[model samples]
Target: MPTGVLYVMSTVVPGLVKIGKTTTGRFDDRMRILERNGYNNVTGLHREFAIEVERYDEKERMLDDIFSKARVPGSELFALDINLAIELLASFEGRQIYPKTSTESKSKVFDDAAKNHQENTDIQCIPEGTYYLDRKRPPLHVEMVVEDGALTIRAGQRVAEHDSDRADDRARELRRATVAADGTVRANVHFSAPSQAAAFIFHLSSSAPNLMALQKVVA
Candidate 1:
């Protein structure tokens, strides 16, 4: 069974919530992605809570059924208001969050990231595409193509993430990306949100999902 993280979120609006899942290490990345797109007319999304489950897909469906009365017109989003929505989640929670494996000190995390970067300087996962993000002057972005669940994050693009555990965890995956004439990053990562993809390329924090705005150049 694929063990992963299940996230339940709500927006500032009264009656809407989101339930989604992702890999354990990629939860923050996933949330940043959803929080970016979770709101309809609100500032952003607020996570109600999240937990790691052995059968995440099954749990999601189970929650969907339990809250069938609050089912909304769209996907995964429920119509239950925030207060009751969160309460229902707590009541119907099937499993608890995954336990931490090891908690590294902030300094150690940075040190380990630097070492991993130096050690993984040769691997590159490059693809072909003229992808662009932002229409501003000197828009910060990458041009890459996807193949076999892997892709290359181009050079010339830089992303600065926070000095928190979230960034430290993401850095491990970021280090393996090899920079080439075209790619400064190459790795076996997949992002559901375009924003998430952009953040991954830029090495930003899990909030990358909220910050990226990449678009295809359409050559």
Candidate 2:
């Protein structure tokens, strides 16, 4: 009796991992099937590793339990780093596929995410007009275009001004991200609370960016 081997997958959509079982040796085919099927949102998919095991369903259940906390609200995807995700999968049976990054890099990743969450600030600038943002950390701040009911933000060619951890560690989930975009992150919101939209796109505190009076050139 040939038992199916369970495979773990990773995608470029940050903080999302996939766990599934494949009976075929060419697991890429299965990935393709998934890409064309339900994973339409996943642009780039990477094969982490396929471990042969007994009772694939049991293995799937076990992985689910281990990552139950990181699992997305309504999907098979788990909100976790691909490397850390692989490590967790390997740890199941004492398997040793460690994370890609070294210990220092891993620590920095978490640390940065934590710093970003803790340093959230309230919006201080007055709203109601267009302006450019300037932050110290994520050097490249994008353009801001204000309109009647919605706000449009261009993407930053460089990283955010203030880089920090995004793991939501220590219950630090601050703002609501309306849209996750490449060149820009948009939020259909009211100007009265424009900071909400700004905080989300730049991944900073609402008050950090001069939402109202920063670079008046945008006015």
Candidate 3:
């Protein structure tokens, strides 16, 4: 049987490192997904090394030795730049190299009053009208367009005239979204009380560029 060490770690562009491990090889998929989603230039390496111990404790000791003898990020032992082999080994530590399955990586956001929507009242609902939106991905702020019956989402200079179903899905997640008959989008979007709603709003604001413009409309 063939056996080898599996590592799961992440590196900072320019320079930084996060190390990890796993028993399986799924880490590769995770790294790919991250790259496709936005994180690029990541690399994974695997290699075989000799073991001097047969017992479990002995093997543990050997791993510890390798760690101690290497210049891993947080390791206090060994000279900072002297361990080439250890640096290579440190690459796989604590990082997942693979992307998770769709089911596993799907967006976890949804309607849940249980999550504290006090601040939900703060999400300003743009009036029913017309506006532009910049399309990209989740966490990217959208442009606001107030109109009647339906709302238009835009990406870049182009409006996302299509994907109404998906757009509606996005709208519904907003507790303060409403659409009116006169083509007016309205919402109070209160941002106070429990920390979760505030956190969620902050997250959306920071991650999504122009989300305040993508205010959900309601009727």
How do these models rank on lDDT, best leading?
1, 2, 3
Please identify which of the two predictions, 2 or 3, would achieve the higher lDDT against the true structure.
Answer: 2
| Predicted candidate 3 versus true structure: per-residue lDDT over 115-215, tens digit per residue | 22222331222233433222245323333443343333322222122223323333334422433332233443322221222222323322121232121
- TM-score of each predicted structure versus truth: 0.38, 0.38, 0.19
Task: Name model 3 segments beyond 4 Å from true.
Answer: 1-4, 8-10, 13-15, 33-219
* CA-lDDT, candidates in order: 0.47, 0.47, 0.28
Worst 10 residues of 1 by lDDT: 120-129
Candidate that would win on lDDT = 1
Clashes of each: 5, 13, 52
Q: How far off is residue 92 in model 1, in Å?
A: 7.3
Model 1 C-alpha lDDT per residue in residues 1-219, reported as the tens digit of each score: 877777667666655677667788888777776677754454468665565657777656655654555666556776644433333233232443422224433223223333332343211212234444442333454555544444444444543332334443554355444333343433344443333454455544533222322333443
Which digits, one per residue and each the tens of the lDDT, describe model 2 over residues 12-35? 786577877776565668867775
Model 2 lowest lDDT segment of ten: 167-176
* Candidate 2 ranges beyond 4 A from true positions: 35-40, 92-219
The reply for model 1, stretches above 4 Å from the true place, is 39-43, 81-219
Native-structure RMSD, model 3: 19.1
